[model samples]
Target: MPYEGPRVYRRDELTYNRYLKVEELLQLQQPQSDPAHHDEMLFIIIHQAYELWFKQIIHEMESCIRAMMAHKALPAYRRLTRIIKIMQLLVNQIHILETMAPIDFLQFREKLNPASGFQSIQFREVEFLAGLGNEKLMGVFLNWPEYRDTLQRRLDGPTLRSAYYDLMRAYKYRIPEKISREPDEKEREQILDALRELYQHPNHKLPVYFLSEALIEFDEYLVLWRQHHVLVVERVIGGRKGTGGSSGVKYLESTTSKRCFPLLWEARTYLTKEPQWEAEENEVSDL
Candidate 1:
């Protein structure tokens, strides 16, 4: 039965090209510029690659949320690590776009009117899933019903921040029932007190401690990406209005101050070793 002269393969066989749909992917880069400016191809490919990575990051973030809900700190932390690595890659990828000279970008920039990177639904999903949902942004997707619906679901769903606080509550931490971007002074104090206790006595809850640190790292890199992106945009366009009719660099600059987990950053202000106290020997279940 082992007598094969020449093995035959089917057209739909699982080869690398078929599995990845490489040919179809290559065909998607149709430049909008008349006669096809050379730099337009670069611009299209870079943004497409960004969408692909955003998809992956969203996948990982959803998994991280599930892990946190299950009270599995290690699994959540692992997913967050992957997300952080992908974000680092994205930060460097922006530099590659910077290689396209300002003059080169101008050649095809007009063709991109009303088609701004600001309309990236997946990026909005990432922000919403991170607990930074803004109802005002719903207007951006008004013309795209499908994308707007998707964003509506994300807005209604639980976020990574909510899941983290729920996990802390499950572990007997005194987390508030509600935490928002702008909490009252007493609410802020309560949240910071809980975080200070964790940082000061991490031995009591090492998994929570490590996972909290990972969340902060994720927040830090997100801000770093925004900062880098603003600098690159300023270098390229220099106060020019965006293709989507926004304030361009000024709008992006404002976003750099947004934090996915503001309490984590605020917690840093309260950390100190002077009044050291030992952690209690209470066991944290389901960690």
Candidate 2:
């Protein structure tokens, strides 16, 4: 199985830092201002690096979701696990961003003008792939063509939502035999169900309890991610409005309430031993 070419493997190429050209990657930091603004350079670099990491995360998530729908389960599972762990690395970045005091950020705040983390298109794409699917948010990237193309492609792709609904329809649900290019009531419901189930990561009384539980772990990590962001902003800049015109802390708090996987969360209220309480309350008191 080994047809090794002359360059089959250069030993140094296998080293930890070999693949990365530090000169090029590290040279991307151009702060757009004077030496009087050294901290701005640090701020700019950290955020730039964060965006790079976000790009990788988005790529992996898209692949994982695609793999799952294609019935290539193992690769998808591995990719998703990697994405969740990358989130931990993402949290560590806040501590780095937090080092810039509010005063430091203010020195170049004018330079930022209308730019804000709220406008990060890659971050938004991550949200969309995680099953949030709010394509209308494409409006946010209207000013940037590169970003618009990337996000619009994700929204318009033969999405996992469509692939999943096909699975459901085959099982006797009154759903479509395939995912449609246009939105449908049934397709939307199926997407919700798939997200909820995947995100909830429940402990079903089933043969493979571990798999069921890992799903819940995935869901929890995703939410933990949102919560972690809220806290990071709170710690870094208290109550200040974002440069992007968003009400900083308040906006992020509101976002944490929106589940990336709605069904996974809602199912708990309806699936657990306590689901009966939900029904009794909904019973005739549909009031």
Candidate 3:
């Protein structure tokens, strides 16, 4: 071991450049122009960064799904916290794209025809895994056989919403079997009634109640990101058609109201307890 006069390091112990492949990553942002538009680099970077974050969000969501399926609340809650944080980034990152004015976008926008953020498979996977599967949306990918096949698999699988009800069932909540596969309005009202009870008497199932609230937070942030996306698109492109052959901002506007976990939000309308707050107010008045 002491034979070497100079110190030596193995390939695994090499520098940051080798470990992270910084050079390779840097090479990925090739501008689609003979002489690139000044803002083209920003455009590519922002979307690329979003795709990278979407990949992480999908990874966390899948892990959460497994935990929920296994009737594990803590693991699922922890993963959902990570997902919420990534969604904050996803919502706020649109501001970076807004910095490039419409005129700047026009310079290289034509070069990006047939390519759109709508085609992001990772984003689609995140939505499908988190319980936003729609056959109409899936149809858009039919021209691309590989993407269509992958999306179809997501549609057939158990969603996080289903797995959530399964988790609640493990905790002895009376969730209907029919609601587990597809959420009907009747089933949703029944679940909302149950959720109101759970939220009102949280001591009965603290972990389950806490997890429900976390899922609601995730849902809220998901809607927020969609809202921000619509605003960003409207600000930059107005009513123009998308590069991907869709009615750009109009399509985005319709998606802002979509809910991943509707019952979680709807149930709050029925939680009318004011005892805790009233007690705090009384104490303040006495003081």
Candidate 4:
């Protein structure tokens, strides 16, 4: 069962070939000041690494939106699927911040020159692409022309929120009657009636399953990502104010409650008349 192999490269020469350029990545950390404090390296590297990851998340989201526009949803769904994995990676990244004690951070925190995640234009653009738009957040990048332009472009264009709604509306109708068969007023009325009853009673079926499950899957991930980010902020930074000038953990925690997909969560209440959401001890118990 044993197989012999080369365990290591024997003084391998650095070929200028087409593999990932190691030197560029290795040299990315350039501290902004001289006599750089020891903790400065740690803080800078951590933030820089995050920006790289943020860029990738943005790239994937743009692809997803584009795919949906082409009416090829599978590609868009595939892109959205990778977001959960990225969120898991991000969760693990919080541990790195945990290693930086307050004393260590204080050594170099004052030298940070007001740079903050609030100024991360790419991050805000990704948020725009995801459909949780806020005009106030857009103002953070107003000083940077390229970034502000990019954010404005995405803001004034089709977003994931509208796409999600379009998908849901398509599902709310039955094919043949609504699509292929051309439903008359009476048929449309019947479709609405059936949906109303199903919403009122659980021992019933929707006109279509594909759309409902898709919407729920999307909504669930949105909720999960928001909650995870809130927890990360709470753990790493605590109650102290954020460098971004917010009220810190409490502020971030309140944001998590602002559901990106509000209607989807509210719609669950209409799923069954006999208490779809029974309030229990500090939790919701759904039946």
Candidate order, lDDT descending: 1, 3, 2, 4
Model 1 earns a TM-score of 0.91
Candidate 3 error regions (>4 Å): 1-13, 180-182, 274-287
Decreasing TM-score order of the candidates: 1, 3, 2, 4
Across residues 1-287, which tens digit of lDDT does each residue of candidate 4 receive? 68787565445654543146767777887776567777677777777777787888788777766765555555666776676567567656656766667666766666774777778787677677766677777777766778777887887776665554344344442322332122366754554454444355332322223333443455565556567666766665567787778887777667666554444455445464453423322342121
Instruction: Looking at model 4, report the run of 10 residues with the lowest lDDT sum.
Output: 173-182
C-alpha lDDT of residue 99 in model 4? 68
Candidate 3, residue 241: how far the Cα is off, in Å:
1.3
lDDT of 2 at 275: 36
Clashing pairs in 2: 196-263, 196-264, 201-215, 201-216
In candidate 3, which residue pairs clash?
A: none
Q: Could you tally the backbone clashes for each prediction?
A: 0, 4, 0, 1
RMSD over all Cα atoms, model 1: 3.5
What is candidate 2's TM-score against the reference?
Answer: 0.71
Compose the digit string of candidate 1's lDDT tens values, residues 1-287: 98769667787678878889899999999999989998898899989999999999999999999999998899999999999999999988888878889999888988889799899999999999998888888898888899988888988888898899888887788888887656788877887888888877776788899899999988988899899899999989999999989899999999999998888888878788654445444545234
Report the number of backbone clashes for model 4. Answer: 1
Per-residue lDDT of 42-111 in model 3, one digit per residue for the tens? Answer: 9888988988898888888888989999999888999999989888888898988888899888888899
